[model samples]
Target: MWAQAKSGPLPHPITAAGTAPVHDPVPGELYFWPTTDVLAVYYADLGQAVPDPGLIRLGAIDTGLDDLAHAGRRVTVRIDIEGVQ
Candidate 1:
């Protein structure tokens, strides 16, 4: 889970693939990476991008306005998704 990722710094930076409307990601759009089983969220109205190749858009987290700059800092990921099926 995300708690594990937060145990330490990430190996690489999770940058926005490109700039998308912060509004595009509400508070429940989650992206899950099956390869590593890692989860991320657009917690803020910053931007959007594929942190990795196997990244899959799963759901979202309503943590509210948290930064997504991962490297030396740990990030808490909470996600929720709806209408997938």
Candidate 2:
């Protein structure tokens, strides 16, 4: 999407929406594929190293460092917590 938007390249279903199609960012598009799907969505990098899509496709991960920028960084996460009965 980012590449296409920047390059004017397009996908199979180009439409009035332009090269980049629109969709809600959360569960709508996030889970559009199985974790193993051969697709990705990218965003701005906050001074981080450029990520290798191959590494991401293979589930390679980064080790978080206790840096000044991340000193108080924390996230509360929940997943699949409902309808388990």
Candidate 3:
């Protein structure tokens, strides 16, 4: 998922620099790119390689990845933290 703002670059909440950046991302993995300020979710590998500074790993999706893969291009999504309100 490459989320881009219509007006300009998206604003990110990253205060510190990337600790562990990766060039290759796997399925169900979540990453944040500081360069574009975009959040990404990898549901499948399309043989894509991330550039330079790479991607900062946020976390992974534990379930419903199949549903995500089949959700098509544009779909409404809601994210909820397990314990945070």
Q: Which stretches in model 3 have alpha-carbon errors above 4 Å?
A: 1-12, 16-18, 83-85
Instruction: Quote the lDDT for 8 in model 3.
Output: 23
Q: What would the per-residue lDDT of candidate 2 be over residues 1-85, giving only the tens digit for each residue?
A: 3321111111232122222222322211111122223233222233333222221211111222123123332423222323458
Better of 1 and 3 by lDDT: 3
lDDT: worst 10-residue window of model 3: 1-10
Q: Tens digit of lDDT per residue, candidate 3, span 21-83?
A: 788887777777767776667777777787888877766778877776777666554445576
> Which segments of candidate 1 are over 4 A away from where they belong?
1-28, 44-52, 67-72, 75-85
lDDT of each candidate versus the true structure: 0.41, 0.24, 0.64
lDDT ranking, best first: 3, 1, 2
Cα RMSD (Å) per model? Answer: 9.8, 13.8, 4.7
User: For model 3, what is the C-alpha lDDT against the true structure?
Assistant: 0.64
- Could you estimate the TM-score for every candidate? 0.34, 0.17, 0.71
The all-Cα superposition gives candidate 1 an RMSD in Å to the true structure of: 9.8
How well does candidate 2 match the true structure in TM-score terms?
0.17
